[model samples]
Target: MEGKNIIYLNDIDGKTRAFTIKVKVVRLWKRSNPKKAGETWAIDMVLMDEKGTKMQATVWSNDFKKHEKILQQNECYTVFKPRFDKNNQKFKHFDTKYVLTFNLETTIRKCNNFIGPTHGFEFSTFKSIKNGGVSSEFRTDFIGYVEEWFAREDTTTRYGKQSYKMDLILRDLEGIALKLTLWEEYCDQMQEYISKNKEEEHIVLIVQFGSVHDYKGTINVANAYYITKLFINERNEEIVNFKRSYIGKASVTTSTHRSIGQSGVTSNEDEFLHNTTFSTIRQIREIAQVMHVIVVGTVMAVDKDSEWYYLGCESCNCKASPSLQFPEDDNGSDDVDPKEVLVCTNKKCKRDVVPAVHMYKVSIQVEDCTGIVNLTLFDRDTVKLWGLSAKQLVDKYLQVSDDEKTIPAEFNAFINKKYAFKIHVKKYNVDNKVDGFSINKLVDDPAIIAKLEKKFDVVPFEEFDSMILPTTVSSSQSDAGVKDSKSYAVDDSTPLPKNYESRKSPCDLKRTLEDSNDLDNSYSVSSTKSRKIETKEDIKAQMKDKLLIPKLEK
Candidate 1:
């Protein structure tokens, strides 16, 4: 821990176009409910570095598995041989930074500010503060308006202190909502109180300078500091360029306000539930932003500690009884028995979720063009979407399906459920709403499978066998080509009448094979001399007497 160098999350960010530095150790998280990402599973520090720089770090897979050591946050390490991510396509970001590897020689040094900088921004006008939160610091003062405020009593560990950081969702007259992150220190030492506040409220501020991090082309604020002394500027202060903002759910008003318009149609609620696309802007009324997100993948992993909170429906909640379960007192017994429960991670959906113990889960490392992220999936939600119970999958894959076995064994017997998420990839923090992704089946879709069956007439072997028999005779096929040999022609005296005409030429008379009763061969001869049946050679020879043509004699 002695010789380690100091660095920031931004010091070796993934925004570099040519080259970037790498940290020996870094922080990473996996989404807890991958189906809906509100929380994430915090994996202890594994060997990592600023990746957008080097070219040789591609073989980090083995190192990743081998360096699963218990490391602390805010620690620095010495990494070796990180590969330059030349294939910027490898991940979503167009960067020169690379991924690092941790070998046996890696050493970690604990440092302060594990959560990174305690940043602040100062602006001359609200417009100067366009779309607040962590972003590429503006070169000059920008201003906006305090459109809404979402505050709660939250315990965050920053600067070694557990305090509240105010989160403000502000919008300029342009009507775009900005996700604002506040510093915890201000909670203890602020001149104006934001509390006792309400929505549609207005606030003003002035801030100092900050950095403009491209963040892999997604410009955002980082390494930004606030001015200790500032004032509220209410007057029109040179409208700083419209907040460099992107639309997200922050502007999408809650479905709670949706009422049945006079048109006899449910407004936003229907759209939120049935429709797949929608938009929201605080004050801006025109632009109709469209977001299409759909994803289908298996629930590959789960980490319990990463979950935020669990709530069940009072009516449909599968829990034996709906009640809170706090820590046990002396006897290790909670006030209520949480025997079973359904907790939907997507609070807006409010559908009861499956109990953690009863759910199936899986893990997958998802990397888009934007960045790499670890994801977690819930068992029941995956099951509901994919239609594969854990037991069924385990039984097919592992040959263990009976419920009589241990619960874990039974759960493993079935195919885990799958889910899909609609995501808009960007360089910075991700905005995960319930509708961010789509849910779909992990196996072949039922509709397509059914259509194939109809087109190809595919019937199960069992049903086909029942409808047909192997030995049954078919009259149309069995009697084919069996000619009768007892025809009247076989009796030479039976067919010639008194007035039978003479044959036209020797060629007309039968000669070669024995023609007696050729019925079995499918050839029958009726003996009443009719036509001058002759080959073309014979006909030409008789052309001098052509008056008797083959059909004329008949």
Candidate 2:
């Protein structure tokens, strides 16, 4: 609906037009240039009209100072003659294809009596998020209760600066759980709330416009760079209704796992195992997408052709494979030769030529009654089965044997041993029709194995080699045969992409209890202070070394 004098947000087309609209500044953030640090590129905002329709608006660097203080978030403003432009960014805030632009002729006037919604939140369902129904190009809102949480991790980033991160398992109203990761200041906000509200039984949290990610075979959600908002146990209608629905539910009980000096792998493995379904080795090969499954298989042989362990970065645990390192100061000695050392392949990692830790990367032939498949066991799961770190085993093997490819006696113990392996089937494996799988976790407990065997039908070990698969078992049939777990667990062992950027906090007006009814409470887990801009010299050095810093996702 359009009036004679005012225009709506959804009515404007990407063309030269003169229009006026009285809208509320739902959210606004300043984007910085990737090439020049601290240089503000544009002031972006999400504006909502009287009809609760949201649209993106932008104020360029030249006009940012003019409207920086004049336009406040959650405040009503009548913007006149704003230009319409196409939204061409790789990552956008909302589904609006066209964005409003502020030119030199654009006029802004405050509207104190404008009747409209202050916030626009379109919450997405767990079913959509779990099945890849939501587009990752745009962030979406999610509401869930915290079922379990891990301790806040205080670690150093590649920049040598200390950072904090925390992981939480969130469950929706339908008993569907998914992993959510909070980084940096977000971690502090949740930790502070937990410390203060230790007696709170149910903590219903809401994340507005959170980025959904699919790591390996697991689907998880995380707060993207500055644009995401958080609300935890707030006295709001949405959260109140959500908490009231789970009043008598025993499954919604919270459990906090303090991982201080404990093995982080145990929690990861437990979450993975709880979510994955049991399948035979033959069923795993027919997977159409990236999926994780449990299979009881016997280790037939250790693939000794490949190295069992690899040198990984000390800080990030990424594989490091740089060229041979020569002595910096040789003193003109010709007798000394260059020593080969493992360097972090991640360009962002500042620790250059540092010591590398030995991490397991063993491949073994695992055979079940259905079929035989190769499984690559990474460090954590390998340590769980071997009862020794890769470094310890390598050291012991080196003391006796010098050949790097030689199978150690310790590793041979896996041969002929039956264990339940959690296999991560990647998209690459499906597309390339590969039978190999990555072992994310392993279970050797006899009681647990017996229970799993009793639940699922398995052929005898004697007929494992001579087993014949049914030709009628299609990929759809295989998937439908197994029980799909509702838990959207995350695989933390996977590394983030090299070009992946971190989040930056956005500045907004903090709302009070008297803000508005039905949409009044929200706590942003972000700093309002400006982030430290990188110097041009620092950027130049990085550019010369081909080590560009990760930029904030806009």
Candidate 3:
């Protein structure tokens, strides 16, 4: 083989072995290290021979521009007089013990007769990655469909370098969802693909040389190194078969699964309904995000203190607050009507106040034997439950006497009534609880309620005690050294002791403390009159007696 001008990747050694071999550029990327001095960029590439042997190769910054355009991916090329270096195992992404480096004398020419393998990807399944035991130094290839993607965010790393990151939820053939992160150039590439192919559904993502990481208990895959490459919806036999077998036939149309009750009042209520698993209020609160669950509870009370309706702009349908402008001669009187004179806060809606529409924003507190939670019903769900629009409710309230400006009796019908709520739990954030609940479907059918009641009766509370219950920490046993101990009752209806203080949600307490701190930082004038300032000359004379004079050195 050596006499025929052919050398395999396994034959390469750190010695100055001169050879000409045909190989294909499998992957290539630029590596930038901020900690390095000038010219800190290098072009890295993975080359595979015709025999399926792979090795790492690099073009240093000085020679990168001259050879970068010549090294086309998947194209066969014959390299002459290439230098061999002992592979750095710590940064190696291939299986070879030696790596190739191009120098000033190294020459490369296109090999028309020989075509080598474009890539040597060893694909791994998400199940195997989740089971662990994979070496951190090893890089794996993965392929899946994009289940969902989040907007890209600019972030600053601890090294004081700026980069962009985007999160993607990838679903495998087995319907298991795994989170994949794209950083820097990869993020920009994916974002561009998404924007250009907005109408192209069923995009298959192929990630080569991605690192498997275990964050907390969830396993995910991310770009391993700078040379990690991404392919989207490429025309290949493996990807084509994957889509056909796992994602169904290409002729079949995929259904768009939108969230329930999001399509306004015209959407079919039954279309979004699901026969979800029954859970208690406590269980629902503790469940993970995006889970569909059914909770049966009685409306304990109506929080009328919160606004039942908000003024929204007609064009954008965004909530609008009243403008601060008022009549000069009004004398800050209460007779001024806000709805008649207010302006929409949305900058897009430059129209008058008459175009503002009324939207419902109702808050109801519901409770079961286990626990309690506040459910926020939006416009569509609010009208479905109350059988009246916010404008109609406002009209009815205005018909009553001026002294009775309270919530109408029609809204109070939900109090003390039992109903099963189908909800898709939003992700919980420690700083905000209001965004954690989204009511999907409201079920009032007696037969469905009866079936759920029978199902709950068969299951014992002890079964879910370990799974859904929130762990409690006693004050005496807490590691924070908190001495004031308090206990929470499972049954929310039970009255608390006189000394027991009610607990507020973390979000509410955080906001309250922040507001108090802002108030404390403001300067307050004690008197209505302003004090006169002393001139610089007056201050100098006043400090003359206190001023110290240094003696002259002899």
Candidate 4:
């Protein structure tokens, strides 16, 4: 009964029930061999019996002359055989045990039996089960923070209008879970629910059915399907424990399942990834002007000279303990350490790989949108546009210590300094939490590489402008003890050289100067302030430097 070749068996719900179902027939159609749609008998309708049991009422020469009343609209009869509609894409079934027919084979009976609701498969309990495949339709209460939301498009047609869709990550008491696709009108409603409450606060919902289809070994839900109801039912600490039938025990069939829903609305994207509103490279540059954008992908090649930072393990945040510089290479031997290192921050690489170079190079990764593509920092141009370092720009988004410098244990465990460092992280992010998730205008234009590069004077890595300078020197040489002195038309109290002025002050000027000197050494004025002097050497040297040029090679 549990395997195959079985009838009158207990259903998946564990209900021990069987019935000799009955049916009353008012109308029937004889399935025929008349070719329709280039096929013989494209599955015509069926008439079932009063016991809900099936028997073929074949349309033959005998039936054409029999049971004329069953074809009448107001007339009724007891009939046999049932036909279920089949979608072309879905597998079609012809009930072999109860073949469909036309004319009645039995008497019409008036029995009292009606269809009942709440009929579906049962699911296994999530607890007390380590792992197994899950299949069922159920109802249960569940809660999860809004990790992410995907809204779908809708359209209209001759069969009235269509609807939208929603995909979300739903976590519960059992554990983190996978994709829940919402169909029809529920899609739009879920969209509104998501936009309003995108934070990590718990949200409760009831799931009717899901995990019906496995896409790429990952459960995926599509439109034209099942239903799930998500609502904020009663808030206690804004959390409620309810039940959903769709939620059930999921078992690990294998490790390559590529877990879904774990990367929900708030789930950190791949380490070192920065998803931007911009999709094109042009757009990437526009945002790079003010904010540094970094997306994480696989390492095609590490920078040749990239400094390797040591970590304890690839999968642990426990940084390796270290002393200082490497011990001097004694006895003409090379220096090496046994420490494990990471070129990237992925804490899960199975093997150690080094960065290809010191300068930022493109990393490749497989993404749903762009497969096996490079993720870059928009550096080629934005480095010149925005002078802000990616590190400093990221600092503004950091949630600073407001608890009187008491560092949270999670952060303290990974950090060794009191201040921000150029430490790489598992996620590249915009300070969306800052200012209502909208970065300031300074960070809006992502293509500001040209603007950023202007702030730093670009010199070769080894060249230093402020460190040293060389210049041509002549008469006024500091190294030769030359000092600039006040210039005068003539030396004081001495006969002037030929062509030098030796003129004495006029009698009136002399009298005024004598009176001014007699009154005070300073009348809020210094004697040097009034002195103005120029020399032939100063003008000739200035002109020569501006105009002189060496002769070109002949």
Candidate 5:
């Protein structure tokens, strides 16, 4: 391995281009284009030099086929005349400032006598990860052993599509535990391994290039889309040494139970939920990221004037909207129901037309000592609250009355009721200045409510009358780094904003329903430029129809 002609990864600079270098393909993955179906975006990889320095590199979709068969993970090759580009992506796997790109003239040849470490990993400590000392912008590697694992779950993603996920409690050698989530194929791999090794203890897991997330002030790791590599109980040198040194020692114990969502809550998640104090409605509004918090509030009133349910796609549960293209009755059949043939608002849905299912979207005004805010209950939470699915309620009300707006008498169960609501506040709500929060989990059990009330020093329900909604949000709230507030309303007869077509999250549907009329609120979207800003008086004037959630100082 000799020569002054060979370039190393660290030798690249701003002016470097079309250079020859010898590096090992430590990792390789095919990047998919989310916008285009079945289309690859690029061929991405991590390349390590002879000195153990690594750099990010890619082959564009146009040139991917040229080197698809030649490039292999853990194989060293001499890459010739590859162009250099700045590594400025939002999520990066390495610390290199520049990434190599294969161009028309780029060539490669296998290096037979390559000498260097086959793998390069710089793992962060569990303490540093929990303390927020590591940079979350770049992906990092971490290794731990599975102390406890949850059963695989089939859950809906943010877009309302069904997906598989698995949760595990991983403990490092230092006795610190961390939560890890595996999505889709990763779950299948883990399940396969578990099925083969029934009695095996101390399952080691190494998450390579995993994404770090801070949820509710606790750090967790999840496998990234395609570039993440998962090594489960592999007989690598580090894993062998880790198991040999700590196999027979005393291990930490954790008791897990199935939570409301049929998912097991890890020890850390349980601590954050039960041990932490409740968050007031005022504090919930100040949150600018995705978080879960418990809030105790009395349901002042329900908006029975609006329709309480929307039709969702049967395939994915996304809100369905009327499409210009109706079902074709080739045989002149009478079986096609116009209500059933609707377009799924979720872009991920593959079908052009899908049958619809009734999903609840009940908005209620909730009041606590802090302030009054609107909370919308989706299908699952509403079903738990009323003990009836949206379809069953709709059928019951249709039998007794002809008016669709008249809610079932059973809906009165929510009025004047005090309950602990686990609200999931998303950044979409904060960014769009939407006041209505979505309830993911609702606890009405008297025992749990009483415990929470005693823990938070609760004020009696009679005293909530003194806590009135604020008429105007303080201008200082904007100066405190919160984004500028804007109000948007959609006119169903008009076309929606172009970007709105891609907005498929549950929060987006809730925001639209809050701003628009009941008849066509399911998939409505309005542009900021077309809507006029409402003043304080205008906001206060609409309080009778839409109760304004005030952003007040804590």
Candidate 6:
């Protein structure tokens, strides 16, 4: 092989020929086989050449000691007398067509004259990953700043082994966010770094050989064992330039900055609606590039044609469909029994079906006096508005007979009722039309509800008690002071109508009581109407006088 020319990965064939190549070991791992009890372990590696081509190589247990110590990661080496074989696509993670297997005749030596980069990576944008069609055959690279992260947790794997997982929210300069999941050793390393750098507000992360996973309608980036490499706040040229492009600049600030509750935003609607402008459905469409707007409309229709919830894989939360069932075997024999399973369509997770979770994705048409528009409510906001979790809604809807083919009565209560919705809008097309709208917050404040009732001629359930009290009083007993009394008395103490049970769910009742308690505890000797208009200073003073506020002891 002295005079043989070096070949790239694309030129590899099964023909026996003498060849010499220089490459670096980018990744290394071990696989075990139960059949060979005495010698079960085999070393596997991913190698990359100067031309940025990669290939998979394996060293069986018989030849492990011969080359295990000689091969070092990120170091160039020259190898000869290697044999090539057809790659098993199911087990291959590299982009090469063939894989290398080491035999007793193979020779490995350190390279002294070669000058090239240790590793080469092809970076992908968040846009492409989010648009779907990311092949699982090969891995990709990603770089972004860590916006937020969750605490490390221990989870039980399908094999009954305990594994640790950490989830990180990453955002790029284009204002796109993606979830990155690290497992086992990677999770430990990240958690260690986070503990050490507790004072740092932002951290830049670089992920190599990370795979894309689709969960429901969202895209996530995950790490593969042994093949994935992570660099956190490293001082490399590429990292330094990426940091400079975003740090200490207004444009970068806007792109990287996010609100405290941006992920879920489950706080009271009053906080979000404080400074927002209220608009009708028609006016909402006329505005351009408005981030948040409030709208009051009657739910004209609930979309029953579309599914209220979807089955998602428990591990990755990707949408899954029922697997095909075969009643008989291929030979037309009835020995095989038919069974149902949920199959994940996402190529990244093609395992045997597992237990699935319910995810909400509901669309409803809302109409105001001016115009009508269709709005969508995702998981969090849907739970808030419907007063039920996705799982609860699925259970309730499935209880009905299949032939009826209608939504639950709880959903029908939403129709012809008024609500103050806080929506986030995105404009699309040349005409600047509002193409995307999602319910961000659900308002139930009496002040806001009263204002909407007066302006839009719509009444909420909470205000119905006040609106009908005056009409129910007898004219003979009416007095000047009767209008000032906030209490209503009935001759009999019978229970309310049964229709009220269908009008509100258990969660709605709990929320109403919580709101009432919040108002009572925050005010002193002030009526509901008076407390609504009180300024921040007045409320603070009232709280200080009536309640003992705790102070931080620093």
- For candidate 5, lDDT tens digit of each residue in 253-355? 1122223222233232343356444676656655677776888776767765557899886546688898653332323344554533367899998655555
Q: Which digits, one per residue and each the tens of the lDDT, describe model 3 over residues 1-554?
A: 32256677787765546787778787777778667855457778888888877788888878866687788665667787788877775676765677888878787876544444445666788777778755557678888877678888999977998888988888788877889999988888888877754434456788988888877887788887576888776534445446545545222222232221121212222332333577766555345455667877667555655677787754445676665543221122345433324566767764444235567777666655443556666664565455456776787777774533377788767776777776666544222222235565565565555555543321222221222223354543334321111111233333333422332211112222222221221111111121212232322333232323332455
- What would the per-residue lDDT of candidate 4 be over residues 310-334, giving only the tens digit for each residue? 2232122223333333322212233
Clashes per candidate (backbone, < 3 Å): 76, 1, 0, 65, 0, 0
* lDDT (C-alpha, whole model) for all candidates: 0.30, 0.64, 0.59, 0.29, 0.65, 0.60
- Give candidate 2 regions above 4 Å deviation: 1-4, 154-163, 249-554
Clashes of 4: 65
Best by lDDT: 5
The digit string of per-residue lDDT tens for model 1 on 1-554 reads 22233343234445532222334332332224446567433232323334322122222334444444534322433332222333343222213343343354443333221222211222433333343343342233334444443454467563676766554444555554544444544433221444321111124333323233443444333122222222232111221112112112223222232221222334433333344332111001111243332222223222222321123322222222243334332223346343333344444543332222223443332221111123334343344333444434554644554432223323333333322232332211122111111121122243322222222111221122222223233554333211211110011123333322443321123432321211121122111211112222322233223232122232
What 10-residue stretch in candidate 4 is worst by lDDT? 433-442
Per-residue lDDT of model 2, residues 43-125, tens digit only: 88878898888887889988876777797666677777888878887778788868788878888876544567535778999
- Write down the TM-score of every candidate: 0.20, 0.44, 0.44, 0.23, 0.45, 0.45
Cα-lDDT of candidate 2: 0.64
Which segments of model 6 are wrong by more than 4 Å? 1-4, 33-40, 158-160, 248-554
Off by over 4 Å in 3: 1-3, 14-16, 33-40, 62-69, 158-160, 249-253, 256-554
Query: Once superposed on the true structure, which residue ranges of model 4 sit more than 4 Å away at CA?
Result: 1-89, 92-121, 124-132, 135-150, 153-164, 184-186, 189-211, 221-554
lDDT of 6 by residue, 210-247 (tens): 88877676788889887788877653434434554445
lDDT of 4 at 464: 19
Per-residue lDDT of 44 in model 1? 23
Q: Can you list the residue pairs that collide in candidate 5? A: none
